[model samples]
Target: RASLPSGFRHLPGHFDRPAQEALVAELRQVITEAPLFTPVMPRTGKPFSVRMSNCGPLGWVSDLRGYRYQPLHPVTGRPWPAMPAVLTALWTELAPDAPPPEACLINFYTGDARMGLHQDRDEDTFDAPVVSVSLGDSALFRIGGQKRNDPTLSVRLASGDVALLGGAARLAFHGIDRLYPGTSTLLRDGGRINLTLRRVTRAA
Candidate 1:
Protein backbone atom coordinates (compact mmCIF):
# COMPACT_ATOMS: atom_id res chain seq x y z
CA ARG A 1 0.00 0.00 0.00
CA ALA A 2 2.06 2.90 -1.28
CA SER A 3 0.65 6.09 0.15
CA LEU A 4 0.46 9.31 -1.80
CA PRO A 5 1.47 12.73 -0.50
CA SER A 6 -0.23 13.92 2.67
CA GLY A 7 -3.29 15.00 0.73
CA PHE A 8 -3.12 12.16 -1.79
CA ARG A 9 -3.09 8.36 -1.62
CA HIS A 10 -2.85 5.50 -4.07
CA LEU A 11 -4.26 2.11 -3.25
CA PRO A 12 -2.80 -0.40 -5.64
CA GLY A 13 -5.07 -3.38 -6.31
CA HIS A 14 -7.57 -1.66 -4.10
CA PHE A 15 -10.56 -3.42 -5.61
CA ASP A 16 -9.86 -7.14 -5.72
CA ARG A 17 -10.33 -9.15 -8.90
CA PRO A 18 -13.81 -10.28 -8.02
CA ALA A 19 -14.79 -6.84 -6.85
CA GLN A 20 -13.56 -5.28 -10.09
CA GLU A 21 -15.53 -7.77 -12.14
CA ALA A 22 -18.65 -7.11 -10.12
CA LEU A 23 -18.25 -3.36 -10.49
CA VAL A 24 -17.85 -3.72 -14.24
CA ALA A 25 -21.03 -5.77 -14.38
CA GLU A 26 -22.90 -3.15 -12.41
CA LEU A 27 -21.59 -0.38 -14.66
CA ARG A 28 -22.61 -2.30 -17.75
CA GLN A 29 -26.08 -2.67 -16.37
CA VAL A 30 -26.27 1.02 -15.64
CA ILE A 31 -25.13 1.85 -19.16
CA THR A 32 -27.80 -0.39 -20.60
CA GLU A 33 -30.37 1.34 -18.44
CA ALA A 34 -29.14 4.90 -19.11
CA PRO A 35 -26.58 4.68 -21.93
CA LEU A 36 -23.39 6.77 -22.40
CA PHE A 37 -23.04 9.77 -24.68
CA THR A 38 -20.51 12.43 -25.54
CA PRO A 39 -21.14 15.79 -23.91
CA VAL A 40 -20.40 19.14 -25.46
CA MET A 41 -17.86 21.61 -24.08
CA PRO A 42 -18.95 24.92 -22.68
CA ARG A 43 -18.53 28.15 -24.71
CA THR A 44 -16.78 26.38 -27.61
CA GLY A 45 -19.73 24.02 -28.11
CA LYS A 46 -17.33 21.23 -28.98
CA PRO A 47 -17.65 17.64 -27.82
CA PHE A 48 -15.49 16.31 -25.01
CA SER A 49 -12.76 13.79 -25.72
CA VAL A 50 -14.19 11.21 -23.35
CA ARG A 51 -17.71 9.84 -23.72
CA MET A 52 -19.38 10.11 -20.34
CA SER A 53 -22.59 9.46 -18.42
CA ASN A 54 -23.57 9.23 -14.79
CA CYS A 55 -25.19 6.96 -12.24
CA GLY A 56 -26.16 8.69 -9.01
CA PRO A 57 -28.50 11.28 -7.55
CA LEU A 58 -26.65 13.98 -9.52
CA GLY A 59 -24.78 13.92 -12.83
CA TRP A 60 -22.11 16.32 -14.01
CA VAL A 61 -22.90 17.97 -17.32
CA SER A 62 -21.14 20.39 -19.65
CA ASP A 63 -22.67 22.57 -22.34
CA LEU A 64 -21.87 25.57 -24.48
CA ARG A 65 -22.40 27.70 -21.42
CA GLY A 66 -20.30 25.81 -18.84
CA TYR A 67 -20.06 22.84 -16.53
CA ARG A 68 -22.69 22.13 -13.90
CA TYR A 69 -24.44 19.35 -12.00
CA GLN A 70 -28.00 18.44 -12.70
CA PRO A 71 -30.49 16.09 -11.14
CA LEU A 72 -31.60 14.75 -14.55
CA HIS A 73 -29.83 13.45 -17.62
CA PRO A 74 -30.03 15.86 -20.51
CA VAL A 75 -30.53 13.11 -23.07
CA THR A 76 -32.83 10.71 -21.21
CA GLY A 77 -34.66 13.56 -19.51
CA ARG A 78 -34.80 11.46 -16.34
CA PRO A 79 -33.17 11.56 -12.96
CA TRP A 80 -29.78 9.90 -12.80
CA PRO A 81 -29.49 6.43 -11.35
CA ALA A 82 -28.81 5.99 -7.66
CA MET A 83 -25.21 5.54 -6.53
CA PRO A 84 -24.22 1.97 -5.83
CA ALA A 85 -23.57 0.98 -2.24
CA VAL A 86 -20.11 -0.27 -3.14
CA LEU A 87 -19.09 3.16 -4.42
CA THR A 88 -20.58 4.93 -1.43
CA ALA A 89 -18.71 2.66 0.94
CA LEU A 90 -15.47 3.22 -0.93
CA TRP A 91 -15.90 6.98 -0.64
CA THR A 92 -16.87 6.88 3.01
CA GLU A 93 -13.77 4.87 3.86
CA LEU A 94 -11.35 6.75 1.63
CA ALA A 95 -12.60 10.30 2.11
CA PRO A 96 -14.21 10.47 5.53
CA ASP A 97 -13.35 14.15 5.82
CA ALA A 98 -15.24 15.03 2.66
CA PRO A 99 -18.97 15.38 2.45
CA PRO A 100 -21.08 12.55 1.06
CA PRO A 101 -20.70 12.51 -2.70
CA GLU A 102 -23.85 13.06 -4.69
CA ALA A 103 -22.37 12.89 -8.20
CA CYS A 104 -20.64 10.02 -9.95
CA LEU A 105 -19.12 10.88 -13.31
CA ILE A 106 -18.52 7.83 -15.48
CA ASN A 107 -16.02 8.27 -18.29
CA PHE A 108 -15.25 5.78 -21.07
CA TYR A 109 -11.88 6.16 -22.75
CA THR A 110 -10.51 4.44 -25.80
CA GLY A 111 -6.82 4.10 -26.60
CA ASP A 112 -6.78 7.50 -28.23
CA ALA A 113 -9.06 9.26 -25.84
CA ARG A 114 -7.31 11.63 -23.46
CA MET A 115 -8.46 14.09 -20.86
CA GLY A 116 -6.92 17.55 -20.70
CA LEU A 117 -5.56 18.90 -17.45
CA HIS A 118 -8.30 20.54 -15.43
CA GLN A 119 -9.46 21.09 -11.89
CA ASP A 120 -12.62 19.77 -10.26
CA ARG A 121 -13.93 23.21 -9.39
CA ASP A 122 -17.56 22.97 -10.41
CA GLU A 123 -18.61 21.65 -7.06
CA ASP A 124 -19.75 24.18 -4.48
CA THR A 125 -17.77 22.52 -1.71
CA PHE A 126 -14.01 21.97 -1.75
CA ASP A 127 -14.09 20.39 1.66
CA ALA A 128 -14.53 16.91 0.14
CA PRO A 129 -11.83 15.08 -1.71
CA VAL A 130 -12.23 13.57 -5.16
CA VAL A 131 -12.15 9.79 -5.38
CA SER A 132 -11.20 8.33 -8.77
CA VAL A 133 -11.21 4.62 -9.54
CA SER A 134 -9.76 3.13 -12.69
CA LEU A 135 -10.75 -0.13 -14.39
CA GLY A 136 -9.60 -2.05 -17.48
CA ASP A 137 -6.58 -0.49 -19.28
CA SER A 138 -3.73 1.36 -17.62
CA ALA A 139 -3.33 5.10 -17.99
CA LEU A 140 -0.64 7.67 -17.35
CA PHE A 141 -2.01 10.16 -14.86
CA ARG A 142 -0.40 13.58 -15.08
CA ILE A 143 -0.82 15.61 -11.92
CA GLY A 144 0.41 19.16 -11.50
CA GLY A 145 0.19 22.09 -9.12
CA GLN A 146 -2.57 24.68 -9.13
CA LYS A 147 -0.79 26.73 -11.76
CA ARG A 148 -0.85 25.65 -15.41
CA ASN A 149 2.90 25.30 -15.91
CA ASP A 150 3.72 24.09 -12.43
CA PRO A 151 5.73 20.96 -11.75
CA THR A 152 3.98 17.68 -12.59
CA LEU A 153 4.20 14.03 -11.66
CA SER A 154 3.09 11.08 -13.74
CA VAL A 155 1.74 7.88 -12.29
CA ARG A 156 0.64 4.69 -13.97
CA LEU A 157 -2.86 3.67 -12.91
CA ALA A 158 -4.16 0.19 -13.67
CA SER A 159 -7.36 -1.70 -13.12
CA GLY A 160 -8.52 -1.93 -9.49
CA ASP A 161 -6.51 1.16 -8.59
CA VAL A 162 -7.99 4.00 -6.58
CA ALA A 163 -6.44 7.49 -6.36
CA LEU A 164 -7.52 10.15 -3.91
CA LEU A 165 -6.99 13.90 -4.39
CA GLY A 166 -7.67 16.10 -1.39
CA GLY A 167 -6.53 18.97 0.87
CA ALA A 168 -4.07 21.34 -0.78
CA ALA A 169 -3.82 19.05 -3.78
CA ARG A 170 -7.59 18.92 -4.16
CA LEU A 171 -7.53 21.67 -6.75
CA ALA A 172 -4.53 20.36 -8.64
CA PHE A 173 -4.62 20.22 -12.43
CA HIS A 174 -4.71 16.64 -13.58
CA GLY A 175 -5.54 14.59 -16.68
CA ILE A 176 -4.94 11.33 -18.48
CA ASP A 177 -2.22 11.36 -21.10
CA ARG A 178 -2.89 7.96 -22.71
CA LEU A 179 -4.24 4.50 -22.09
CA TYR A 180 -2.18 1.37 -22.63
CA PRO A 181 -4.21 -0.87 -24.93
CA GLY A 182 -5.01 -4.43 -23.83
CA THR A 183 -3.39 -3.95 -20.46
CA SER A 184 -6.25 -5.23 -18.30
CA THR A 185 -8.22 -8.45 -18.76
CA LEU A 186 -11.33 -7.10 -17.06
CA LEU A 187 -12.80 -4.97 -19.82
CA ARG A 188 -14.82 -6.47 -22.64
CA ASP A 189 -13.26 -4.06 -25.08
CA GLY A 190 -9.70 -2.72 -25.01
CA GLY A 191 -10.35 0.53 -23.18
CA ARG A 192 -10.64 2.13 -19.76
CA ILE A 193 -13.49 3.11 -17.47
CA ASN A 194 -12.98 5.84 -14.88
CA LEU A 195 -15.46 6.64 -12.14
CA THR A 196 -14.98 9.94 -10.30
CA LEU A 197 -16.96 10.56 -7.13
CA ARG A 198 -17.44 14.09 -5.79
CA ARG A 199 -19.44 16.00 -3.21
CA VAL A 200 -21.26 18.65 -5.19
CA THR A 201 -22.74 20.68 -2.38
CA ARG A 202 -24.05 20.59 1.15
CA ALA A 203 -27.18 18.54 1.63
CA ALA A 204 -30.41 20.52 1.72
Candidate 2:
Protein backbone atom coordinates (compact mmCIF):
# COMPACT_ATOMS: atom_id res chain seq x y z
CA ARG A 1 0.00 0.00 0.00
CA ALA A 2 1.39 3.37 -1.05
CA SER A 3 1.70 6.11 1.51
CA LEU A 4 -1.49 8.16 1.89
CA PRO A 5 -1.44 11.82 0.95
CA SER A 6 -0.44 14.32 3.59
CA GLY A 7 -3.11 15.22 6.16
CA PHE A 8 -4.99 12.00 5.50
CA ARG A 9 -5.73 9.77 8.51
CA HIS A 10 -7.25 6.35 8.27
CA LEU A 11 -8.47 4.56 11.43
CA PRO A 12 -9.46 1.06 10.65
CA GLY A 13 -12.19 -0.44 12.87
CA HIS A 14 -12.74 2.74 14.77
CA PHE A 15 -16.13 1.37 15.71
CA ASP A 16 -16.63 -2.10 17.04
CA ARG A 17 -19.48 -4.27 15.79
CA PRO A 18 -21.76 -3.23 18.61
CA ALA A 19 -21.00 0.42 18.07
CA GLN A 20 -21.52 0.15 14.32
CA GLU A 21 -24.88 -1.48 14.90
CA ALA A 22 -25.84 1.29 17.30
CA LEU A 23 -24.94 3.93 14.72
CA VAL A 24 -27.03 2.18 12.10
CA ALA A 25 -29.97 2.18 14.46
CA GLU A 26 -29.70 5.93 14.78
CA LEU A 27 -29.42 6.30 11.00
CA ARG A 28 -32.62 4.36 10.50
CA GLN A 29 -34.52 7.12 12.28
CA VAL A 30 -32.71 9.76 10.29
CA ILE A 31 -33.58 8.10 7.01
CA THR A 32 -37.19 7.94 8.06
CA GLU A 33 -37.32 11.70 8.58
CA ALA A 34 -35.25 12.58 5.54
CA PRO A 35 -35.62 9.96 2.88
CA LEU A 36 -32.71 9.38 0.58
CA PHE A 37 -33.08 11.33 -2.67
CA THR A 38 -31.12 11.13 -5.86
CA PRO A 39 -28.96 14.14 -6.55
CA VAL A 40 -28.48 15.24 -10.14
CA MET A 41 -25.69 17.12 -11.87
CA PRO A 42 -26.03 20.89 -12.05
CA ARG A 43 -26.96 21.47 -15.69
CA THR A 44 -26.98 18.02 -17.20
CA GLY A 45 -29.58 16.85 -14.66
CA LYS A 46 -27.81 13.52 -14.71
CA PRO A 47 -28.44 11.72 -11.42
CA PHE A 48 -25.56 10.55 -9.29
CA SER A 49 -25.07 6.85 -8.85
CA VAL A 50 -25.67 6.93 -5.08
CA ARG A 51 -28.76 7.89 -3.11
CA MET A 52 -28.26 10.55 -0.43
CA SER A 53 -29.87 12.00 2.67
CA ASN A 54 -28.58 14.40 5.27
CA CYS A 55 -28.88 15.11 8.97
CA GLY A 56 -27.71 18.41 10.41
CA PRO A 57 -28.44 22.13 10.62
CA LEU A 58 -27.42 22.31 6.96
CA GLY A 59 -27.60 19.61 4.33
CA TRP A 60 -25.62 19.28 1.10
CA VAL A 61 -27.80 18.95 -1.97
CA SER A 62 -27.41 18.84 -5.74
CA ASP A 63 -29.83 19.68 -8.49
CA LEU A 64 -30.18 22.00 -11.51
CA ARG A 65 -28.77 24.77 -9.30
CA GLY A 66 -25.68 22.74 -8.31
CA TYR A 67 -24.14 21.65 -5.00
CA ARG A 68 -24.81 23.85 -2.00
CA TYR A 69 -25.79 23.70 1.64
CA GLN A 70 -29.39 24.33 2.57
CA PRO A 71 -31.57 23.91 5.66
CA LEU A 72 -34.39 21.98 4.05
CA HIS A 73 -34.69 18.72 2.24
CA PRO A 74 -35.28 18.97 -1.52
CA VAL A 75 -38.00 16.34 -1.59
CA THR A 76 -39.59 16.69 1.85
CA GLY A 77 -39.45 20.48 1.94
CA ARG A 78 -38.68 20.12 5.64
CA PRO A 79 -35.68 20.67 7.85
CA TRP A 80 -33.27 17.79 7.74
CA PRO A 81 -33.14 15.37 10.62
CA ALA A 82 -30.93 16.35 13.53
CA MET A 83 -27.30 15.28 13.36
CA PRO A 84 -26.78 12.09 15.32
CA ALA A 85 -24.90 12.41 18.58
CA VAL A 86 -22.58 9.54 17.75
CA LEU A 87 -21.36 11.40 14.69
CA THR A 88 -20.82 14.56 16.66
CA ALA A 89 -18.83 12.60 19.20
CA LEU A 90 -16.78 11.05 16.44
CA TRP A 91 -15.99 14.46 14.95
CA THR A 92 -15.09 15.89 18.33
CA GLU A 93 -12.76 13.00 19.10
CA LEU A 94 -10.96 13.15 15.77
CA ALA A 95 -11.10 16.90 15.11
CA PRO A 96 -11.02 18.44 18.54
CA ASP A 97 -9.94 21.85 17.30
CA ALA A 98 -12.47 22.23 14.49
CA PRO A 99 -15.94 23.62 14.77
CA PRO A 100 -18.84 21.32 15.32
CA PRO A 101 -19.99 19.85 12.02
CA GLU A 102 -23.10 21.36 10.51
CA ALA A 103 -23.71 18.71 7.90
CA CYS A 104 -23.68 14.95 7.86
CA LEU A 105 -24.12 13.68 4.30
CA ILE A 106 -25.54 10.19 4.22
CA ASN A 107 -24.65 8.31 1.07
CA PHE A 108 -26.30 4.95 0.51
CA TYR A 109 -24.68 2.84 -2.17
CA THR A 110 -26.16 -0.25 -3.69
CA GLY A 111 -25.42 -2.37 -6.75
CA ASP A 112 -22.68 -0.59 -8.69
CA ALA A 113 -23.04 2.89 -7.24
CA ARG A 114 -19.83 4.90 -6.84
CA MET A 115 -18.61 8.47 -6.36
CA GLY A 116 -16.17 10.22 -8.71
CA LEU A 117 -12.98 12.00 -7.72
CA HIS A 118 -13.77 15.50 -6.47
CA GLN A 119 -12.75 18.09 -3.91
CA ASP A 120 -15.00 18.95 -0.98
CA ARG A 121 -14.73 22.68 -1.59
CA ASP A 122 -18.35 23.55 -0.96
CA GLU A 123 -17.76 24.37 2.68
CA ASP A 124 -16.96 27.88 3.77
CA THR A 125 -14.19 26.81 6.11
CA PHE A 126 -11.37 24.60 4.91
CA ASP A 127 -9.87 24.65 8.38
CA ALA A 128 -12.28 21.97 9.51
CA PRO A 129 -11.74 18.39 8.49
CA VAL A 130 -14.23 16.02 6.94
CA VAL A 131 -14.81 12.86 9.00
CA SER A 132 -16.01 9.91 6.95
CA VAL A 133 -17.42 6.71 8.44
CA SER A 134 -18.02 3.50 6.55
CA LEU A 135 -20.63 0.83 7.28
CA GLY A 136 -21.75 -2.37 5.63
CA ASP A 137 -19.72 -3.67 2.64
CA SER A 138 -16.14 -2.59 2.11
CA ALA A 139 -15.12 -0.36 -0.80
CA LEU A 140 -12.02 0.80 -2.65
CA PHE A 141 -11.41 4.42 -1.65
CA ARG A 142 -9.10 6.51 -3.81
CA ILE A 143 -7.38 9.71 -2.78
CA GLY A 144 -5.26 12.18 -4.71
CA GLY A 145 -3.66 15.53 -4.14
CA GLN A 146 -5.35 18.91 -4.52
CA LYS A 147 -5.38 18.51 -8.30
CA ARG A 148 -7.63 16.04 -10.02
CA ASN A 149 -4.80 14.46 -12.03
CA ASP A 150 -2.46 14.06 -9.06
CA PRO A 151 -1.22 10.57 -8.33
CA THR A 152 -3.73 8.54 -6.32
CA LEU A 153 -3.74 5.63 -3.85
CA SER A 154 -6.49 3.08 -3.36
CA VAL A 155 -7.57 1.94 0.12
CA ARG A 156 -9.96 -0.76 1.11
CA LEU A 157 -12.36 0.83 3.57
CA ALA A 158 -14.40 -1.63 5.58
CA SER A 159 -17.27 -1.36 7.98
CA GLY A 160 -16.53 0.44 11.26
CA ASP A 161 -13.54 2.17 9.66
CA VAL A 162 -13.05 5.93 9.78
CA ALA A 163 -11.01 8.36 7.69
CA LEU A 164 -10.22 11.99 8.41
CA LEU A 165 -9.30 14.40 5.65
CA GLY A 166 -7.90 17.47 7.31
CA GLY A 167 -5.18 20.12 7.04
CA ALA A 168 -3.55 19.93 3.60
CA ALA A 169 -5.72 17.07 2.43
CA ARG A 170 -8.97 18.87 3.22
CA LEU A 171 -9.34 19.80 -0.45
CA ALA A 172 -7.86 16.60 -1.83
CA PHE A 173 -9.63 14.89 -4.71
CA HIS A 174 -11.10 11.61 -3.50
CA GLY A 175 -13.93 9.15 -4.17
CA ILE A 176 -14.95 5.54 -4.12
CA ASP A 177 -13.98 3.57 -7.19
CA ARG A 178 -15.93 0.39 -6.45
CA LEU A 179 -17.28 -1.79 -3.68
CA TYR A 180 -16.50 -5.31 -2.55
CA PRO A 181 -19.86 -6.90 -1.97
CA GLY A 182 -20.53 -9.42 0.80
CA THR A 183 -17.54 -8.13 2.70
CA SER A 184 -19.63 -7.29 5.76
CA THR A 185 -23.00 -8.00 7.28
CA LEU A 186 -23.65 -4.62 8.79
CA LEU A 187 -26.37 -3.60 6.38
CA ARG A 188 -29.37 -5.86 6.22
CA ASP A 189 -29.78 -5.28 2.48
CA GLY A 190 -26.12 -5.91 1.72
CA GLY A 191 -24.93 -2.49 0.56
CA ARG A 192 -22.81 0.31 1.95
CA ILE A 193 -23.60 3.43 3.97
CA ASN A 194 -21.12 6.29 4.19
CA LEU A 195 -21.50 9.11 6.67
CA THR A 196 -19.51 12.25 5.94
CA LEU A 197 -19.37 14.83 8.72
CA ARG A 198 -18.49 18.32 7.53
CA ARG A 199 -18.54 21.81 8.94
CA VAL A 200 -20.31 23.88 6.32
CA THR A 201 -19.76 27.35 7.70
CA ARG A 202 -17.12 29.20 9.64
CA ALA A 203 -17.50 29.23 13.37
CA ALA A 204 -18.91 32.40 14.91
Error of 1 at 15 (Å): 0.5
36-103 per-residue lDDT for model 1 (tens digits): 88888888888887999898888999988789999988888988888888999999999776668899
- How many pairs of residues in model 1 come into backbone collision? 1
**Steric clash pairs (candidate 1):** 43-64
Clashes of each: 1, 0
Q: Which stretches of candidate 2 lie over 4 Å from their true place?
A: none
Off by over 4 Å in 1: 1-5
Per-residue error for 137 in candidate 1, Å, reads 0.3
Candidate 2, clashing residue pairs? Answer: none
The 10 consecutive residues of candidate 1 with the worst lDDT sum are 1-10
Model 1, 101: alpha-carbon shift in Å?
A: 1.1
